[model samples]
Target: MNYFSHNPLNRFSEIRPDTAKMGELWRHEQARVLVVSNNLSLLQAEAREAAFLQQQEAVALANQAEVRVYLGSEGEVPYFALGFAGLPPALLPEAYELHDLRQVALQLPQEQSALLAYARGMVHWNLRHLYCPDCGSLTYSTAAGHVRQCSSEACNKHHFPRTDTAIIVLISEGDACLLGRQKVWQPGMYAVIAGFLEPGETLEQAVAREAEEETGVSLQSIAYHSSQPWPFPSSIMVGFQAVAVNRELQVNYDEMEDARWFTREQIVAGLQNGTLRMPPQFSISFRLIRDWFNQTGAYKLEELVSA
Candidate 1:
């Protein structure tokens, strides 16, 4: 998804749009990327070798194999790219670990292109989620890399790749937008109001509810903008513009230290000076906030998760 963000994501007939199409493309060249696992006691240096040696069952043909995705390499390092046909059977019992794609992406060098990030992340998801919850049997990669189907002849359940759907909104009244900061945020860093989408809720509903719940401000109108695939463990952030008919700051210490309105002048200073830390440039939120400000002033439309 990040790969398509730059290129003709739609133009590439080879690229899959949603989870289904995407997985189809991934399985065709699915490679195993390793994340140091708890079993290995990766915190210790000596433990890794023994863990690797012990994981005979999982590494049948993996070792001595060209590490396709090297921790440090020009191309991908030594990693097993498995096919839907014999993956789980090839990898079990050994304790060799697998990590979610998002976690892996976090550790990668900033220079690593988004394409590698996407490929590695997607494959990792397939590797970790190899079984169906319904039948409790192993599920094989399917629909290319987009899905996993239970091997049980009877249950036949299908599991698709999942991305957390959240709505991040620019709640504005006049020349100001609502912003807040998590206690964990970089000092002085503040960004748009956001929250996950609960079941039975639409993006607009989520936005309105989050604004009300987080800041006790009721939104009058909601406008859908764009989206971004946040592989911070796989979330797709949908962006929105909500007009706040009133100005009110509410604090919910459990989630945020504070919530309040930021006039256009305040945001402009924050962006240019970095005196106020913004979300990484790679994040849609940064772009969203940036674009919004640029357009008469806030984040861009495409800065949303979907766009």
Candidate 2:
């Protein structure tokens, strides 16, 4: 129930969207231009409407570009501009940096982050899946940029945008939640156990499986905490609270570097002054942990700090 305000990284504005895109002719006309980040951060404002109208100017400013629409909530919310690219990995980083599209949402101002993230993720999916996997021929976008269908009649394949489900679980005992640090993580910091959802596994099952696999710590009664639509390419991180069934600590070195339990006292210090530090406030993981403390009524920080 504890929600964060416009805490910069914490903002993921809910823009109730309705996608009316349909038919082949309409898809042909809808812009396939690449949207840039430079425009929204600099020129955008609450009262400013002119910046949203200047679609041509934005295209002209780009070094190399294509024509795409800025899919916004109303007529001109300017969520994120679209770009037309066949293969994103081949693009030059200096001239035009291509991304997974999910990470972009994390970097933006929170108010429009989720909206833009959703738009970009679905669009990116459409870009790559232009051909039917079954027939190896061109496919077209459908469902208002939400789907792709093969052009070949003999091998008609329909593809939908994917959102792989994963869970980030905070394994807690009396005063501690078991945390692990990945090889890629910063020093002195640890976080909840996480993993991808295997075939037919429930969110709770995924949490238990991931925690046991990563740290060899069994979890019981995992409860959903919160969910954030993470775009890193396309993932939905569902945060959870799981009771520690077994206390023995074991680390699966293949998945994690260090895994251990951190007491509430240490968590308090880390939340305030931080050690090697934890996940930034922009991430849903931080919010889950923050809410955990708030639920216990033992700790509460006034500022919805993202750092």
Most TM-score-accurate candidate:
2
Determine which window of 10 residues in candidate 2 has minimal summed lDDT.
2-11
| RMSD per model, one decimal | 9.5, 7.0
Clash count of each predicted structure = 39, 12
TM-score of 2: 0.71
Model 2, 81-175: lDDT tens digits are: 44455323333222334343333434544544544454455555665677788889998754445557789988878887788888888788887
Model 1 accuracy (lDDT, Cα): 0.56
lDDT of 1 by residue, 134-204 (tens): 97998876544466789999998988768789999888898887788898887888888899999999888
Q: Estimated TM-score per prediction?
A: 0.63, 0.71
